[model samples]
Target: MRLSRYFLPVTKETPADAQIVSHKLMLRAGLVRQTAAGIYAWLPLGLKVLTRIEQIVREEQDRAGAIELLMPTIQSADLWRQSGRYDAYGPEMLRILDRHQREMLYGPTNEEMITLLFKDGARSYRDLPRTLYHIQWKFRDEVRPRFGVMRGREFLMKDAYSFDLDEEGLKQSYEAMFVAYLRTFARMGLQAVPVRAPTGPIGGNLSHEFHILADTGESALFYDAAIDEVTREELLSADASTITRLTDLYAMEEEEHAKVETCPVPAERLRTRRGIEVGHIFAFGTKYSASMGLSVQTKEGGQVHPHMGSYGIGVSRLMGAIIEASHDENGIIWPESVAPFQVGLINMRADDAGCAEAADRLYERLREAGIETLYDDRDERGGAKFATMDVIGLPWQLIVGPKGLEKGVVELKNRATGEREELSVESALARLVG
Candidate 1:
């Protein structure tokens, strides 16, 4: 996309309200704007990154056999009442009333709604094991919403509900989601460690919170060093015995940690790091199902409540968490999978005829090759242009100036490595496209 045509309203001055680096950069880059205290309107550039992240999450969910279906942002309060959570959910639940004075609410989670839906249609045991997921906006009235999207009151989340006929079936469903979460974060260039977490309001005895370590993170986590090397494919392909072996690896949140004489790793490798909770999985057996009368007939002709599990990923919060985990002094070093654009083309002399010609040709070449290229063809000074491009931190950058154009050579720079090479336009194109 051409910079002149794009709506990226980048600014040099950082906003005083932004306390964190990700929040500050997001504002400076014109990625998002505050619509309310904790609500934001995602700008074009921000939306592009969000969409990319969502696609990766969707793909991973689909791979795990979870079907996607959207639920409503607003839900009937009667559903929560049926689940006996209307009064228990506390202030985080945004209770509301319609014009006719009927009780309503903006759903913070879909346990109650999903349970009612499952109970209504799924009567027999034929649909015993089914997983339904949705990527949608959620609202929670945070008393103090801070750190941009990291703790926003209104944000996007991908929540999935799994229904199984029995306890054993529920375990299998949980395992599938656990493996899917690992692959989803890995594909986004994040190493998320699964740690046992508090159930909180989403009451469940079995729960795991996937955390990405960052200094600015909110939660303190402890885990064995070996978890870093474990891959999703390894876990997914493992047998029941292997699954037990892998799951036995020591990992827990600070709340669950109890000092022991024997630890899994040596003292040096016993790492305790502050991390942001990116995703969470829960197995709440018969919690909502029993309360909402979500029961199915057994083969023996007895009514039984289906076991349920809910998995959630903080979709919008991940944008901030990723920036916190993967940025330098320059700006965001976006992972290629979630980058707004794959490459940034800098024409040092946008007004100059020769430089413009070379940049235009390179831009077309990259676009035709299926590369997402952002051409910085604005008439700015070379230093300013370089600084801007570096701040945005595209993986690859092509610099075409008057001198380089005259010599039929352009400079190519890899943003991550800070490596630069002078090559002919054809050579650069081949190197990038190939």
Candidate 2:
């Protein structure tokens, strides 16, 4: 994508309304624009990052044997009434009325709706163990929505529903989702720790919230420092024997902490830090299924309520949370996995014939190699172009100038590491394309 032809409306001055680092950087980088108090219109760059994150989440869910399906943004209120949550859900539910005066809602979650769907078609235990997921937008009317997308009124969410025949079967479904969440965050270059959390309105005795530690995070979390070094491969890449071994690690929220005298590590090894909740999993046995009449016939020819679980990942909130965890003082240093573009080609002398020729050739070479390259073909000052490229935070930057064009050399700089090297045009192209 050529920068001159792109719609990247970057700003040098920080907007006064943005209070947090991610919020401010998002605006300055031209990733998003506020259309309302908490609602935002994701610009081209922001949509690219959001799509990448969604793909990662989808792949991980597929690997865990979860089937994908899309659900609608609007739902009938009759389903919520069947589950006895019509009035219990409170004002955040965003209740509405159609022209016919029928009650409807922009679903905040899909527990009741999914339950009704399951009850209608699934009749026998043969379809007992099924995991269904959808990536869709959700609306929750927060009275005071703030923190950019982190606490927005409307956002994208990846919610999965699992069904099982019995308590033992439910455990397997829960474990699968637990492993899936770990793999999802790991693929995004984030270390998310699973901590026991209150079910809240979701209503489940067993729940876990995956949090990524950041200074600007909303929740204060406590965990063993050993969790920081534990990888998803360490937990999920082993046999059933190893599952017990990895699950023994001490990790929980402050509410679940015990005051036992014996400690696994030492008091010093315990780390309490602020973190943002990225994903949550809950196993609510017979809660919605029973109320909604979602029953399946067992081997004994008896009808029983199917145990269920719901898993959620705040898809849009992750965009902000990732920026919070990854950005530097200058701008966002995007991980290669979620970067909008792999390289930024800055034509230091866009008006100069030699510099333009060199940059154009490099840009074509990078694109032909299947790299996402953004060529700055604008006739802007060298310093301004470089600063904008840095603030945009492309993984690599290639500079073409008149002096370098004469020597058949270009400057390559790594965004993560502040290392700059002058190399032949061929070498620079190889570094970027290879």
Candidate 3:
């Protein structure tokens, strides 16, 4: 992608309405724009990052044995009524009426819709265990939505529903998702800690929220420091017992922490930190199935309500969370996995025919090598171009200037480390492509 042809509307001045670091940075970097209060239109650059994050979530869900299917943004209010939550959901539900005077709503969640779908489609015990997921937009009428996408009223979410015949089966599904969440966040260069959290609104007896530690996070966590030691290898090999091993260590949100009669961890081992909640999983036995008449036949010729669990990852909010966890004073330092473009090819002297030609050739080479590179071919000053590259936070910046090109080399700079070294054109290609 060439910057001259791109639609990035970057700015040097921060908006007064933007309060948080992620919100301010997102605006200044031209990643998103506010169309309405608590709502944003994801610009091209922002959409690329969001798509990358969504794909990671999808891949991990598939690896965990969950099937994918898309659901609609608008749902019949009758579905919520069937689950006994139409009114109970409160003002955030965004109730509406169609021309026929029938009730409708922009779904905040899909528990009711998914439960009914499974009940209508699957009849026998043969379909006893199934986990279905979808990535779509959902809206909630928040009274005050701030922090950019972090608390947006309209956002993208990956919510999965698991149906099982028995309590034991639900536990297995929950643990599988638990492990998948760990792997998903780790792949995006985040260390998310699972902490026991209240079900609230979703209504489940057992629930856990995965949070990424950051000073600007909304949730305060009190946990055993050892919880942070769980590694990617362990998560990959994890089973049902993985839940026991991690949750057994003391970890709780502030509300849960305050209710503890006695602290489990010794003084030194207890760690308190602020974390942004990115994912949540719930095992609510028979909550939706029983109410919505979703039951499977038993071998004994009996009908029993299927146990259900819901897992959610804030697909859009994650962008803000990542920025919160991984940005510096310069701008967002995107992880390679979720970066919009892996390399920012800056033509420091675009007006110089030699520099422009070399930069264009390098961009083509990077693209041919299956690398995603953004070529800044705009007629701009070197300092301004460098600042823009840093603001967008591509993993690497390939600098092409007459002086460097004349020396038979180009400068390669690491965005995160600010390490710059002159390398032969071929060497630069090999390093980035590798």
- Compared with the true structure, what per-residue lDDT tens digits does model 1 show for residues 163-234? 999999999999888878877887877878777777888887999888988988888777777776676566
Every candidate's lDDT = 0.87, 0.86, 0.92
**Model 2 Cα lDDT, one tens digit per residue, 1-434:** 99899999999999998889999999999999999878999999999999999999999889888999888889999888888889999999899999999999999999987887778779898987999999999999999998899989999999999999988988899888888887788777787877777899999798888898899998776677877767657644534443344356666655566554565757888888888999999999999988887889998999999999999999999999899998888898888989999999999987788778878988888888898998999989999998888888889988888887777688999998979999997788777766
Error of 3 at 314 (Å): 0.3
Higher-ranked by TM-score: 2 or 3:
3
Q: Tell me the alpha-carbon RMSD of every candidate.
A: 2.0, 2.0, 1.2
TM-score of 1: 0.95
Clashing pairs in 1: none
Error of 2 at 295 (Å): 1.2
Q: What is the lDDT of residue 296 in candidate 3?
A: 88
- After superposition, candidate 2 runs with Cα above 4 Å error: 231-247, 254-265
Cα-based TM-score, every candidate: 0.95, 0.95, 0.98
Residue by residue across 1-434, what tens digits does model 3's lDDT show?
99999999988887999988999999999999999988999999999999999999999999999999988888998889888999899999898899999999999999999998898898878987999999999999999999999998999999999999899999989988998998899888888888888898899899999999999999899999898788867765667677788889988889889999999899999999999999999999999999998888988889999999999999999999999998888899999999999999999887888788888888888989999999999998888898898888899999988998778999999999999999999999999988
